[model samples]
Target: MFRYLASASAMALMTNGPVFAQEHDHDHEDVTLYRVFVGDHADAKVTAFDLTEPDRRWTFDTTGQSKLYAVDNGSAVVAVQSNDDAVHFFTSGISLHAHGDHADIEVTEPAAIDQSLTGPRPFHVIDHDGKVVINFDRGGYAEIIDGHELSHGELESTQLKQARAHHGYAAPIGDLWVTSVASDAPVEGDAAPSRVGLQAINADGAPAGDVATCTGIHGEAFSGAFLATGCDEGVLTVSDGSDGPIMKMLEYPDDLPTGESTGTLLGSKSMQVFLGNYGAKGLVVIDPVDEPHFRYVELPFRRVDFVLDAANARFGYVLTEDGSLHQLDLLNAEVTKSAKITEPYSMDGDWNDPRPRLAMAGDEIVMSDPNAGLVRRISSESLEEVGTVEVEGQPYNIAVAGGSGVDHGAEADEHEHEAHDHAHSHDHDSKIYQGYFDDAQIAERQLSDWAGDWQSVYPLLQDGVLDPVMEHKAENGDQSAEEYRAYYEIGYKTDIDRITIEGDAVTFYQAGKPLAAQYASDGFEVLTYAKGNRGVRFIFEKTGGDEAAPRFIQFSDHAIAPQDAGHYHLYWGDDRAALLEEVTNWPTYYPSSLDGAQIVKEMIAH
Candidate 1:
């Protein structure tokens, strides 16, 4: 797919005109500006098209065959040359802003190849949190380049080299670097190494320790703070630890029949899991923390490309060669929906043949059809074709950039109108409270803070008193309250994941379930439950500036009456002195059971 070149006449037809004019209309305010940078293998150029307006934004002329890699959340695209030893960066010229209720995107001039790096066989480029790591497999070295610097024509890089040369990958995690290990010995013929290991390099450019063995490790991905590298045996999991980075190997289940090992690994940002390609007709769902981590799903045909829904944690889209899009539910490990969007592009040619590539542009799934020289857009919500944009030559490698955001111009106008209509003001004095109270008196005050570690501590106030039956049931547990509390705290700290904020929605996947929260007020949000009467209300209040002690409160009718009906205080700190201060100085009540109090005391003592 990377071998096509443009003719002289065809190259002359492509224009460098302004893709988007500086016309800021109210209609453009709420609309998401989508840009698809297509690397035409046959044309040897990158074309930028505004999918929102359905127009060609601009075209970048690459001197040779290239492959495009999206970086900085699609704000930029890097075209790595296939015929030479060089890489180029193209700015999508789209800026996204979030204003809670809506979004605004500004489309500017496309910056083509503003900065580039040259090396021997610069092929693999991976974007990790805005840092682009380009691996020169043939040269046995990799360069980590700052994505922001590259966009501004500034070059900042860290060079990492292995002991021997092989086709491998590398990723930077804080001060440490994880890279694929080279083959121990050179093969006599053309056969490649069957197995390889991984090594960690410290910031000082020295090996941290011995290599971790994994048979035939190829692709790598990151979900939350966890990193997964696909291997023949299973998957090598890497996570940041207090000491450094910890590595573990999660093998496939013995009951599952073995096939070809996964070479491409895709991590879901919303969940602590990894999605991998199993051979040519299957998809593997892997959860590093779960027992029997691997779950395979058979496909109808060979997969063309797939992408996880950034806005919907539970949904993923897979475009097969049969010209159909299948929506996958990661929670159930099954395809819940499917739609045919294009003509069948059989997977019967060379691996490098121009086919289709899938990418998510906000709520839309963009698929590039190289054979048709067109890009198809499908709504992720409906799983139906929305629009299509035609490009010059064969549009092979495609990357999308843009999102919804509120327009500041419209917001300013609305505020101006509101000011003229009514003089709205807030009373800051009434919101602030200052006091000291004993634990008993504090319990009578309204609960304010709720952001902290909380669990169901039994003797769950049945009626207005602790239930003896539930209390005894809790006491029969294998682990003591102190032990369980300690263990829970450790796990909670280690599993520090985050949710994605898009418009009014905050979406994330937790405990194999999709969870979402919608913005309500300044310090309040609404959490929607899959099976519940009304969504729970989450109210956050900043009690003190010292250590920023913010309290989280959950209000729901379904909660246990009286005790949980009001605001429920969530305790997070293990400092006994701090806890005592909160109990004595703060006007709040600890509504936990007697055992809960004991657990808190033990945690504080430890």
Candidate 2:
């Protein structure tokens, strides 16, 4: 009878185990793990840990107080020592790179400081592309160094000086330098400059244009092609133009409460928006690209630390003083999910006290708990607690440095064949031609022949209208039939003076100064010519083909294509005589679908 009962129990258990078995199998699958790096100030050490593993991978002790910055897609980490007045770079040990369909991460021996930089009061460090810019507040100068040069022990550096240096910042973008402009007014009993201006320096170290003025200028952020500087009155927006950097002010809404401007701004990697702290308990989303540009989201408590989810363009993680992690949906501008990961840590203490900090490792969000001596990993997608690693001492500052890598074993044969094929292919050599025009009329005339858009060349005329030809007298007083065309065209002007293409990289120039530009996608490039608390972006795309002169379309912002088309187009080749004939017979040459005449009237009316 006992045997019979046992058989019946086994049968019943098997019938109900399918669901449990499926869940277990799903969780045990080979999931990609990301690595997290933490900087413990009190311990004077930096530690690395794998989120999926329980053991700590490695740790490095520093000379003094340390702040961590992960550069080159987590290939290395730079620790800025506050008291020591030096910065140290170390290999993260976890090497991550793309292969084909997937990514791979290699865990190697922990490396010591590969390079060291010494300066006075080195506070802010910025990584624009591979170049690192460190600002020495007390020293009143900034150092620009190349990351690749660190390994050769021959790093090239450029020193930038401020006007009257009082804890300011400076950055070098391409051939342009944007630095803080100190006020000339005398200090009144410990008060510094009430108003500061942003100054642009050209390649030759001369002023590019007039200083962009802003009162109480502070924090800075970059989105897409533009850089924004915050101020008491408004946000200063800067962009690259054909002539020089253009500065504009986006004033705060009249109905909004006063005394609430951000000094700390976080830029998004996927979207053209900025996340900033508003007041003490609120967060502001600044989207300069669209309508209702500024949106505020109120938090339950003051934010402890927050970071943009670079992998996910739509989400950001915010940790509040309540020890709760909230997922911010950038699209909806709301908190979509929340999870309590740690004990309550009040924000009422001194600013320098050890507090929780946030970092992202792939799809996982890592939060360092200084008081608990722990780092908790949570899944960004599900908002669930996944794992935790015990850390020694107070882990105040934290950064993550690993991503997905392709499996070598899975695609070894496929990659080898592709490599062999690429080795024998002929390479295409592309060159960039930059054109500068002092007058808009001449620029439009030049661009029209290349883009095949006669309407843009002559914005005031109708589709069937022809540019009038005038009879002129030559030097000998002989009558000569010459076409007299109006120079001024009705369109938004560009700040870009020239464009350059070297290999796959494309750069733009303004006032004979080169600005940093990146390929946004196929046939499109976004140029950042302005540098400072505020900067500018010029989006250009290649159109047409060998059948006609290749046309270049320049857009004011990133939004390109029809309905939301570009501001103008620049046509290649200077066939003025051919273009003149084509424009004269507009009905035969111009596209009937394009209502150029109506578009110009609407643009002018607006």
Candidate 3:
């Protein structure tokens, strides 16, 4: 059985027609099954596999040679749209169409036309809540296709267009999409564009007559209560919704000296939002709900583009031109963390160089690493390295399956722990404080002040908490799940470290001794800066719950362990990593002292 790993070769081979068998190493009723539907940068071929299962492989080449990007609308079906003006549907069912049949090749149905749209140059396609929406740039129009199978095999499209042609999008509701249309007159040069706005289009192509226009409106996002619109002057705030879905344009509000911004990102967690840099080197957050002022949040590097953390809901990731995934915090709108992804794709070249694009498949995030030729998985929760898999030539888009078929049993178990514990903590008498801290963070912030990054990134942080000891457990059995280089292990009891065994879990560093116990999984790096020695370590601890006896958390610091090691961590980062592990509902914050003990005890009593 083949498990996806992170590497250059893996990225190169991500899109091809070959089924594979992947192993499952868990004690459960079912097996780990996954099928990744990948589209190439150059080739018109579409790759499919049971990402979780990896037991078989499938491939379907698009009828027309168009660049394809896909979004999973649940089940094993994917909605794919290429540069060409059409949307295709591909399924992973074993039944095969004739080899000569490009349209019939394993297709449950024929290709769906973007009838709602008039002009070509198809832009983007998104499947929100089973509604398939297609965007056309040539003509400022969008079409919607429902995911449900109708009695007839023919596919239908719904039309929704703006008054003028401009570049924009449809709001989340799938009804009213925010878009841009052509200006009234021509510009100084061929560079066209006049005004942009939030146009409410009904299901049948008709503008609601109410348009909240922004001069340079480009990108936007809408929650039920508020809508963030990006433009030149600043974020245009429109809180005056007569009723129904509120619409407002938040002009560029950050204090940057660059040009203008249209790329606006909205977080699902704290209602915070982000705006890409004017020229691409900067980003900012405008929390109109909290701080109405446009705040310029600096970034480590300028981004080619950025993606919202759908699974994580709180944080988002940016793929820089330098080939790195910088972890972003939407609540605060800042670059919180970063990790290298590839050896850097040539930015000096053309716009369509088959560079890696960032996408989330379940909790696993797949980046098309052209130089690395591999797609790696970063723990959405821990934001640490977990595992990776190889793919073919410049994987442009990735559509994952089976994760829906079988929710990450292990990953879900981890989330269940937080959900149940969170409710329990709220009821607990604990003072309700922030959770844990990193080495650099520990110096400036107290352990009890873990909020945004500290809490959501590591569930140990929250609004209110009592005497709380946020501990993580990891274990290693004879058969390890992923194989890679370097790992972390729970080692000996040192003068500063205390190791205790309470049942199956080997609790280490009770009072925060390791400085940063971030890597609580097998074979992690310590990153000893003062000493400047890079090595590796191995550790194994068991889960601390009754539901499953062998549950544990391990740590492998690259500086202290051997290379070629890997493990699955999905509970902490941005919930985009593919390392879906088996999880259980356990306590996230365990009381080890009196401060929050009474609260927890009170919660336990109920």
**Candidate 3 per-residue lDDT over residues 179-273, each given as its tens digit:** 44446676676464676555555656566546665666655543323456566666654332344345554454435556756455542321334
TM-score of each: 0.64, 0.63, 0.53
Rate residue 475 of model 1 by lDDT: 51
lDDT of 1 by residue, 1-606 (tens): 011111111111111100111111222233346677888867768888787776657888886667887665455678888567888887777644211111234457778755577877787777774478888877778888876555444667888876666778888765688888867776877665444888888755478867898878888887755788888887899987766678999877775567777788887654567788888888888888866588887889889888777654567789888889999988788999899988898889887788888887756788888878788888887888888888878888887776543334423322211111112322211001001112232122123222222233221222313233223222532223343333223212312122232444433334434444443322322221111111222332333332322233222221221222211222223242233212101111222322444433322221
Question: Residue-pair clashes per candidate, as listed?
Answer: 12, 18, 148
Global lDDT scores for all candidate models: 0.56, 0.53, 0.40
Angstrom error at residue 349, model 3? 3.6
- Candidate 3 versus the native: TM-score? 0.53
- Tens-place lDDT digits, model 2, residues 395-463: 879887655432233222221111111122211111010111122211111222112222232422322
Stretches of candidate 2 exceeding 4 Å from the true structure: 1-33, 54-56, 94-107, 150-155, 187-195, 203-206, 407-415, 418-606
List candidate 1 stretches off by more than 4 Å: 1-31, 97-106, 151-153, 189-195, 409-606
